[model samples]
Target chain A: MNARLYSVVFTFVLTTIFVLCLAGINALASGTIEKNEQLEFQRSLVYVFNIAEDIDSISDEKILSLYGNRIEEITGDQTVYVVNKDGSKELAFAVQSPGLWGTITALVAFNEGGTKITGIDFVSHSETPGLGGRIDEVLFKEQFRGERISSDPSARVAVVSGQDTDSKEDARVDAITGATRTSESVQILLNKAINSVLPVVREVVE
Target chain B: MAESKKTVFLANIWKNNPVIVQILGICSALAVTNNLTNTLIMGVGLIFVTAFSSLTISALRRMIPKNVRMMVQVLIIATYVIILDIVLKAYLPSISKALGPYVGLIITNCIIMGRAEAFAQSHGSVLSFLDGVSAGIGYSLVLLAVAFIRELLGFGTVFGVRVMPGGFTPWVIMIMAPSAFFILGAIIWIARTPIVKKK
Candidate 1:
């Protein structure tokens, strides 16, 4: 009985020590980690704006300076980021849709007119790597640039296949060859973002 | 008794590799191996979690009640994995984003649990710590090897730099998960030959 009690006490003490050590390490790294996340968000914002400069080459201070209080968050039924470029407004909003494996969350930036996609960046996703995951790659994302949303309320952005996108003026993106499901999800997400969030922003901006 | 520590360390790397020999952690091995850098970071992260968790569990082995042992073990492992996830998100946001949900999935990795139950439970704290590190290194080495093959063939590159000749056409299939299944199977086959022969 004495031996068993001793064993129990020993285990309790050891587990306590382990937990404390991990807590200490986490505390130490917490500040740097937070700063990195902020910087990354800033970088993503810059990319959506089609800023040609290198994101990392510029310091966080510079990114913050460029941002220059131009960004605002809407507090309402849905959260949206409002960025003013001169008198015109650009609104960045988050959209979530199901991918092949799991949910995908993206930050989509649209011009005030809601006619053009200013920029887009994936905030989070769980798509299959090297296939569905290529949506996060710059080359795939670049296709969305300057895409004009069709004015017809009934018509949505169509992700087409095996066709040359000669008409950049149309808001049609060529879906990735092998990632039909993931590409379809992106189209669905954009449709939701445009229909639901764009109307809200249009009211605020107009 | 002294030699036992040395044997445990060596055994994890070759005779009982967690990925190749035991065939654990195949999911991340397939998912992240498309890029060398992500694969390396994932391996390092796993090593850190496995090593420290082993040390902690081994030290507490005597006191934890047998009835509640698995629960406590999971709790302990989860805490460390969360710490790893937080640190990565804070410091290496890009890599962290690339890694996605796999970092969280480390808690469910069988190797960490296997080590805690099989080795840490029976061993002293110091020996168990070494065993954990050995197991992690063993896992990392095999993953790196698989990553090397996958990245090179899939992208025609190493560590994201283009390496194939100008005229070379990259194999698109190499980038997919099915390719990893084939490559890993080949590796397991080759690795098991000597062991089978010796037996």
Candidate 2:
């Protein structure tokens, strides 16, 4: 065999064997990976709905149980998760908004009337850790819990830095310091969620 | 051969450390060092990829055509990295998420390729594996040190546990990528002083 031809053949053969091995491994792990993702999404749903306490400490089975018993998935123009809370129906939906580095996908919940946010949990984001990534911290997400959403589409829920306001009616939350772009992204994200997705979700609920 | 297994292994950790000496893999060293947990996981992931890839490359050194050896080494390295990513997704979803693209980026870490081309090409499988592991450890040691400072000052935490006093002011700069450069530079400077003096 010519040396060049042999090299090419060897490379091709090696690539095929490696790709096959990767494919086999991926196939074997895909099921568990999918299940893990599904469970994570479910856990985030349960968290955003505020149906459970200390969600991090709860077992996977408990989360599955809570999701099963309390949450109902409604697929319409937008997929929404509905949970009956204290005799009132609340809705939660996934929202994708651009962060500094990449997309920030969050599960955002709304109150029974869609007038206020009930809770929020970030499903995935690529923001820099300890800076923009602080958006995932409880201190940041907790501000949205029961925060009033303004009727004004432009500034539905204001995420401002150095704000002294703590009133839920103001719909304002302090953004993480040193993360100005991410803070603005959060404001933009909320504006879109409130102005666009909420109406569609409300229609779906109706 | 005076270059025994111990020297091959120990050289990478200190005398010829990948991060501080050879200066390979500084990209990930800077990128993932902001958080201790993430840095630790990244270190382990890099070690896993480097060790296996080096072993595989050494085992096939004779068979790999010299002209196409680099391509073959990359294929082997990439296979292990993807497998690590898949396993992490299946069993450790949260860490997997935190590490995110850095796991996939392990294929591009220069340490694995450097070991493959420099040491593995001429070494035996077991010795090459040791070289790979030690190189990874050398890289990890520097990264973890950098992360320890960053996480401690930036988040007032160690491995996510709050360790600082209640009023300790967190330094915002420490949380960003620039801080890694300063820290890593200082580490390299400190680690190389004695070696430079002897030479």
Model 2, backbone clash pairs (residues 3+ apart or across chains), number: 0
Docking class of 1: acceptable
Number of the top DockQ candidate: 2
Task: Output the lDDT of residue A189, model 1.
Answer: 83
**Worst 10-residue lDDT window, candidate 1 chain A:** A150-159
> Which candidate number would show the highest lDDT if scored against the true structure?
2
Kindly list the per-residue Cα lDDT of model 2 for residues A105-149, writing each as its tens digit.
988899878899999898888887768888889889989999998
**What is the model-wide C-alpha lDDT for candidate 1?**
0.81
lDDT of 2 by residue, B60-90 (tens): 9999999988889899999999999999999
TM-score of chain A of 1: 0.85
Candidate 2 C-alpha error for residue B150, in Å: 2.5
